[model samples]
Target chain A: MEIMELTALELGREIKKKEVSVREAAQAFLTRIAQTDKVLNSFVTVEEEQVLQRADEVQSALDGGASLGPLAGVPAAVKDNICTEGIKTTCSSRILYNFIPPYSAQAVLQMQKQGAVILGKTNMDEFAMGSTTETSAFGPTKNPWNTEHVPGGSSGGSCVAVAACEAPYALGSDTGGSIRQPSSFCGVTGLKPTYGTVSRYGLIAYGSSLDQIGPIAKDISDCAAILEMIASYDPKDSTSVKRADCDFTAALTDDVKGMRIGIPTDYFGEGLEEEVKQAVLQVAEVLRQKGAVVEEFPLSLVDYAIPAYYVIASAEASSNLARFDGVKYGYRASAYDGLHGMYKKSRSEGFGEEVKRRIMLGSFVLSSGYYDAYYLKALRTKALIRRAFDAAFEKYDVILAPASPGTAPKLGQSLGDPLKMYLGDIYTISANLAGLPGVSVPCRVDQNGLPIGVQMLGNCFMEKKIIRAAYAFEQARGRWQAPPQAQRKFEKETVSASADDMQRKEKEMRSASAKDVWKTEVKTVSASAGKAVD
Target chain B: MANKISDETIEYVGILAKLELSDTEKEQAKSDIERMLDYIDKLNELDTSDVEPLSHVFPVNNVFREDVVTNGDERARLLENAPAAKDGAFQVPKTVE
Candidate 1:
């Protein structure tokens, strides 16, 4: 009866079995988004017309006896931070609020090619700063389970969209646990693939090295299907890996038979909520029963990740975000004739508070005197953190930890305290620092009925192993209960085929002079080491 | 100097970030930054002399692909986002003159 609550795999089966029409399934998501998005505030822009047209095309293909893809006809959403052509792909920042990218992000384009019916673009923290989605220029995406409670962000909307079943799957970019923290809080599944596994062509840079595009879905299987569609050797992205001979979905197996799963004592220690710890241990027990050799390993210095991540992420962010300076793209403030006026008015009017804070902090760290003391130190510590993970992984196939310390906290509580919200990334940051594959799978619901997640971290390019292990846990954890509020999301979905609104967005953005930033028209700045690989 | 970070430094950083800050922010950032710097200074005490500084965690090895000029999609939308443009190129205020 509730087709919206079904996983991508389940929906695919239903469509193939002729039990549900692809068009009907697309409509169910549209309807769900329309009804529930008001409360959840997950999606910033939904292309309803595009969803129906894409569904029709898929249906036509199915009728003509064409083989459907893994996630055929499944409705999915994109994070606003990711580039989507002709759409208002804001990084939830005012600078890019009215900006429509010339190209779609590599991940979005790939997912579309796989016949995944894109539902819409979801909200995020402005420029992917701040842990709570509250920093979004479009406003915070409320948790589907509780409107008053904060959805952990900057990918909070993506996580909430999946958790609330506005779409069965969504794409999110994680820099310092943007994807995983929200995934944990929203009680859904998300994976921050190995650093170079997914291309970053279209996703705007938050913290360049720290940023990775990942999948947020209801289950590990859904996450896997989306990953298969998105992951590949993208020549456009220099960091992309040549696709090794691997099938992530096919690698899903219940046998960890003799596989070593490590529970780092530091991960389970102080500040970890009892409910989340219990949930992680329960999942570990399931793995143990499946013949996994589980052990308590020592990574005692894990407490240092927050400060290191902040410094590194902010330091990089300072330079990366300097691109939207009212000259090239997006909104520029009026009443400014001079260059300095343009910079001041544009940035001050464009950026939200958290983004401003991060940019300022970043600029400070990277400034002349502070670079060695702050930025360089953070980079050095990042190496140490990577070594800790590498040492642990030499003994263990995968590392297990509670994704966030607890369920989604009450909204407005985490907003005031930036450092406290940052602590949620304590368990997730090291993986990004190490360039390892990490997956967050929901294990159980706490007494409060909010979901608790156990994250599995694997060695580089070992997404297959992590996906397999996460799938095994999903099977053990039993079926997830889609939130009730996300179910009524039976509303219309709207896609931009370049009508009046696109013209208006263009008109609003028409001011000052611009330049093509892609072709190296701007000034070439030096990297820290001076002319190494930029 | 006790290897100490100061209020003036935070204020200077805030200026670089283009943040118009108040008195409270200046003090708060000074304290917060000092706390972080102090924590990171613990690494200075570590004997990492023999260990080579690892810049990238993954073995990237300059993994570059052949550069091919792929046609960028959406001819009209490319200009849609420009604050100002003409003849398919973005127009900007004169500089480097």
Candidate 2:
């Protein structure tokens, strides 16, 4: 069997049976990564030697008659945004490009304790500002499915790694749609656990209020299994939630018989392309067919999500990112003689355009005169959105939506108008604003055969139900296809279709939408290169 | 959009942020701030009277644990990467200097 194709559960069983040494398992993945990483570029750094060493240590433990842990020998990748002790966690920004942290995140520590081998840090957008990995300062991560296309971001590298079968699973941070969008694009299961479900001690804050570190995996079970390990309260993270007293893994039984699924009319009404809407509704139909009662729900306040999220997240980010000045930590400007010069040089040289743009916007929103009007008012509107969700979830077990309006757009296509790019996250951002647990499960492929993900949203701390729904959907829909490049030349040719055709076809898909007024297509001509014109 | 932000307001913000902007940057900041402010102006259309303001999306409050220390004696590692330190504290140039 191809070692790369083994799920975490399979790998665990193999190691437990002693059919394969942990070192050998880690080595197999490292070798596979070395062979194909040139094409995938899924990893920003591959901690090869240390991984083998840790695997050997696990093997030594097992050989010495110690009880093997549940996730023994499972190798996983982490988004660089999540800090790992003594690793260069750049978040794909020049500011922290060489930052070696002294401590690992609590989630990473939990995974390590489960006997999961740490592979390496994966790439992301600088400060996780962009939906496409094209904003990465290091370079864009190519979709393993098609190298020319983008793997969704800011967790693009993590999703791409899982999609390409580089690792059994990867940890990704979602602020807005980072994890789910990338998962949707790459054809994997990704979850953004309820805001406080997982500890956020060492996650580099992109949007402090919204950022959540969760699992991106080949299937929902693996995603839930990983979350089960990582989700717990920690004294270190003020946002951590106490234990929910329910076993997430056990909660995933095929029991949607009495489940009330809410299909938000606003989610499918406008902006969603025909194929994505059809794919989402098809899943809704399947749920209905399976005896689950599905209803069309309403959230009048949900349309204000992007604007509310931008105001709140950007304001928080401005405050959080202020710590990156030259004096404290991160990249320092040694060329400057004075303190002011040092700070300016460091920031000007370090931040990307998007990062700078957010800071400026954030500063403006939180600034005097604007604070009460913009930031405070947006917060109030955010409550309205949350209240609506709170009311709907009272009648529904799960809310449904398309994770992204459509599959991954060509890189340069969405970048021309920033507002248009912001709308790509419209369907997913509200979940973050509501601090709800959400999962994006690949429902079906589009007309162009690129993947589309349908979102399953749940009330706060009900991650188990979200995962259960996603898992059941996966059991029905099937395991995601390994990115075509994972195979040989013939498969590569099949995946490597023309970008022009993909974009034009995506536009045509939008044109065919049942609702004519949404104007989903923004014919961005600049996506001619690797990704965003940015 | 007005496409105008007072130069005085820009200077005030720069001061608050401890930034010294170039004259050209001041012009750019003015326009960007105006556009962003204009965009944000749309929030007034929202009727939030019935809404209870949420400080956190998750219904978590006072997540504070016991104020007891749990083996947090890592001053050495904390100082290990400091750009400058002296006598178990971060060093800075004299404020009066």
Candidate 3:
């Protein structure tokens, strides 16, 4: 099997057994990314030299009889919003395009301490404001399942990176369903830990009260292991929780006997597509067969989640993002009248339309005359929503719902109608409001071949329950099959090229038009004599 | 109570946000905010009079630590990313005449 086909743990086990060198593993993924990322556009920055140097350092450590964690020697991608010391973390926005952090995020530091090799920074929606990654200044990431569709966002690039096998696993931040929605659209497993479970110290804030970083990988086991490595308390972020039970991997058992799973009837209503409903309901059916007591329950105030979420998140975002005036590290306008002019011009020129819109809305709601009616009302509504979840969790061990209302829409379908896009977040946003642990596992694919994810939410800090339920559901669902593009190996002549020649080819391919590259990729996949891996 | 968002409101909000929107963008923002307000008006239907507002999900508060500095001065490193810097300070446009 190819190195890219191995799960992160499997790759780590091979490296520990001396069967595969860390350098070889990193090279395989870097080469795969070089070959595929031109069409996917999943990465914002990939420093090959740094990746190789880190791989060698880890390899030497292992050789010297140093014991790294389970993910030691594994190459992982990081979402662009997460700060990496000395690496450009742009949040996929032009404002911070040249901004490199002087310090890394607490999660990135933990990943490094676990001996994971950093592949590069992945693209995301500008400041992580939009549902579809089309809001990114770098350009939207196309779905690996169908190149014509969006890969969901603002964690689109992170999800696409894992889906296309560009990286085995990646870290993505979830604020109002960024991680779960994209994971659903890309057919991968993503976990958004209960708020405060992961520290937000170095994560570029969009909505401070809601943002939590978690893992995106091919399966639940990888998600659990990655979560185990990154979840920790830090003094830097005041919201960080000190939890004694951070052993996420211990919940990977395929036993859901006597587990009470509640399917929210509100999630299955109205906007949910027929196929998506069936796919999600099918997960509950499978769980029921495995001795889980499944029943449909009303999760009230579902309709109010989107509005309350937008208001609260936007309010927090406006406050959090006020730090980006031209005075500091981000983009500065070339000419302006004074300090205020510079701030206005730099921000107006830097931020994308969606971000500016949210800022404006946030400002309007917080303005003196409207504060009581909009912002405070939203907060009160948020309290009620949390109460609703609290009431539901009293009887249910896990709440099963669709991650997204439907499968991945065509690339341009979502952005035109922003309200429609906001409504699509109905199923996932409630978890963010209540600070619940949620996991998105690929249940099945629609008729169009795009994947549908079944989201399972557990009460605050009950990550183990959702992980165990998701693991059991995944076992019943069988192994996940990669998209056709990800399964294809390059032709023999291209594969056998010298290192310099391959690099030159990769450069040429990147500079070529995306259409031409797509045609070349199609031809190469067709010409390959190798069979597709299951 | 979905009050119609006016052009004056959009312009004023733009000022509050420190964003300079062109006339066309203002028109767009007016319509978008109007629609959003219309949707948000649904919250008025629910009775939240007795509910306390939730500012954060976690109940933890007053997180305090020692006043001693954990990080040493890294002025040079921090200034490296500044758009303009001089004398170990970030330089901005003239604030006061």
Interface RMSD of each: 7.7, 13.0, 12.2
Q: lDDT tens digits, residues A1-534, model 2?
A: 777787777788888888888887888778777766655667777778888888888788777877655677788899998999977787887777556788999998888877878988897888889898877766677786666678888899999888887888999999898999999999888999888778999998877778899999888778778888888788788877787653678877766777889998877777789999888989988887777898997767766888888898888888888887754445554444345655666676677767776777788778988787788888898888887888998999899889998788876676566777888898889888888889998877777758888999999878777776776776677666776567652233423333343444345334323111211111122233222211
lDDT per residue for candidate 1 within A1-534, as digits (tens), equals: 488778888988888887888899999888877777656678878878877998999888888887767677777889998988767788876688667777789998888776777788888988888777888766677787766678888899899888887788899998878888888888888899888889999989988787899998888877887788899778677777787744678877776888899998988878889989988988889999988899998975587677778888887888888787776788666544346556766777777767776777778778887787667777777777888877887899988888888888887788676766777788988888878888888787788867778899998878887887887877787888876555444232232322343443344344322233312322331233243111
TM for every model, in the order presented, reads: 0.88, 0.88, 0.93
Docking quality tier of model 1: acceptable
In angstroms, give how far residue B35 of model 2 lies from its true place: 3.4
Candidate lDDT scores, in order, read 0.77, 0.77, 0.87
List model 1 lDDT by residue over B11-57, tens digit each: 67765765445678667666656655665565665455455445566
Best-performing candidate as measured by lDDT: 3
RMSD of each: 7.3, 10.7, 10.1
B26: Cα error in model 1, Å = 5.9
Which residue pairs in candidate 3 have backbone atoms (N, alpha carbon, C) closer than 3 angstroms, thus clashing? none
* Per-candidate clashes, comma-separated: 14, 4, 0
Ranking by lDDT: 3, 2, 1
Candidate number that wins on DockQ, 1 or 2: 1
Off by over 4 Å in 1: A484-534, B1-47, B61-68, B72-76, B86-97
Best of the two (2, 3) by TM-score: 3
Model 2: residues >4 Å from true position, as ranges?
A489-534, B1-3, B14-30, B50-52, B59-76, B83-96
